[model samples]
Target: MGSLFEELEAREATARKRVEALEAEVAEVSGRLSAAREGLERLRIARETVAEVLAEMTPEKPGVAVDTDRSSAVDSVASAYAGAERHVIGVLTVPNWQPGMGAEVLPRVYRDILEVVTDARGPVRAKQIVPRIGLPAEAGKIEGTRSKLKRLVERGWLDEDTPGMFTPARRRGGASPNSR
Candidate 1:
């Protein structure tokens, strides 16, 4: 009787493990289903976008000519937007700064780095900035600074004129560290 009871207990434990595994599988299937639903939504959006674009380009009436004026207007708007974007230094607002303090939102090292680069009248290299920013001559520090500068360019805080050369991005109203 004792041996029989032990066998039943072991079987129960095994059953429990099997049930847990099945539950895990169910959860995985649920996640996959969710992802499939999201993909379907994206497909729907894409289809709608293509339909809208086709409608715009196609003539609504059988004999109507494609609207040249509408096409020209679109072109004008695109060029104007591009010109405006190119003229502005960065997309972000230029926060007011106390000459030496830099922007409050930036890290101390970043402010130091920006100050050095902007103080240079023209585009400066990462090598040039490292010393002025007081970073050590180690290769790691130099590379790190270079990466930071690149990121700054991406964030619209700085501009890259040449490979590895950086300059201050102009503010929306033409104000910048140099202008100030």
Candidate 2:
């Protein structure tokens, strides 16, 4: 009986040691996992910063000189593309039945629209703008949005570099046409 009691004591000691070792291993693994997560977060932030810098560094189309008067328009376009990448798309809303109001009102709406487009990260279509600005979805069906976008291009608030690809003017001074 004494020998049996001794054996049981030895077994309990071994089991306790095993539990302690397992606890230590668990703590080490948890620390490693936390470190890895922190590293991943840092990488994600770095990637986003790099992407924004690259986008800003990219130049507009070659052989097309952007008008100096359209500097605000160009800035708006770049801002929009960057904003879109960050997932903050806004709409340009105008009061109903106020088209004939005044030049002041017109500039306000244009500024609002420009703000939305400039802050977006990608090319925003007229259809998307209507919904974002709190206008009826049918605004796209009407000729109004289309005409407004065209006017924006004419006024140098937006630039239609290609048939469907609209970008801001190249007045903010990042890359030159020769570099693109």
Candidate 3:
């Protein structure tokens, strides 16, 4: 009976030591998990702070004035279509006129006209472009808008499906023919 009692005491001691070691391991793992979670939370907060700061800052201005001019041309064309009593049948082709000479003389007007034309459903004729693109009424006398459309077609901005009918080149994935 005395030996049996001693054996029971030794077994209890062994069990207690194992339980203590397991408890220590559990505590170490729990500490590591908590530290990792805190690090993740800090990173999330940093990202949100950066986003908020950027939102508070003023947006970057356009690099070139020519881009604004092209945008204005697009606006003018849209406005013209909006006010027209006639259903918009086609796009307008503005003359290749730049305000100044030099490297600034990019044919942006053709691209702008193509953008507006492609936004429409039907073919756009040259006569329709004069008033819409902010061109002078006298533009009608300058070999007519037909010649301007032909010029655009030659540049690949406008496609002449027939003699007088014109359409914009098909665009895909936010890219246009002249975007590159």
Candidate 4:
């Protein structure tokens, strides 16, 4: 009877030791998981910041580099965010036209507007362009088209000779074909 009691005590001691070991392992694994999550979060933030900076960049000079100030800032930011996972989101905006650049860079709607203006026999009105671009002939649509036309003109992608009249911008050597 004494031997049976001693055996029960020994088994209880072994079970307690096993439970303690498992608890320590669980704590260690939880700490590792928390560190991994923090690292992943840092990486995500870095990737988003980089995407924004890249989206804001403009193709200024052909062979020459531009925006040295911005470039340096990007470099510092990139180094700080190194080892992050790759996930990117960007916003597209109308870019100021540069020589040797093509219309491909423009967003779809802007390209459509340019195409309509370019195909027109002469200067076109926003109202005329609105329907041609497949928009309803409504006041709101016309106004929106006009705003885009003005933006194109401001970006040097189009020329506005008269009020509410839009045409393709003239080249350096000669006037736009529609201008004549």
Number of the top lDDT candidate: 4
User: What is the lDDT, from 0 to 100, of the residue 122 in candidate 3?
Assistant: 83
- In candidate 1, residue 179 scores what lDDT? 31
RMSD of each: 14.2, 18.0, 22.0, 15.4
User: For every model in order, what is the number of clashing pairs?
Assistant: 1, 11, 3, 0
Comparing 1 and 3 by TM-score, which wins? 1
Give model 2's TM-score versus the native structure. Answer: 0.34
Deviation from native of the Cα of residue 81 in model 2, angstroms: 43
In model 2, which runs have C-alpha deviations exceeding 4 angstroms?
Answer: 1-106, 139-142, 172-180
Model 2 poorest ten-residue lDDT run? 88-97
* Candidate 4 structure quality by residue, lDDT tens digits, 1-180: 999999999999999999999999999999999999989978875754454355444546221122335455445445545775632222324556665778998878889999999999999999999888898898866886887787688767899889888888986654333222
Indicate the residue-level lDDT of 153 in model 4: 80
What ranges in model 1 sit over 4 Å off? Answer: 1-102, 172-180
lDDT of each: 0.63, 0.54, 0.53, 0.71
TM-score of each: 0.39, 0.34, 0.33, 0.48
The better candidate by lDDT, 3 or 4, is 4
Clashing pairs in 1: 89-170
Task: Candidate 4: count the clashes.
Answer: 0
Q: Lowest summed lDDT over 10 consecutive residues: which window, candidate 4?
A: 61-70
Displacement of residue 90 (Cα, Å) in model 2 is: 29
At residue 165, candidate 1 shows an lDDT of: 84
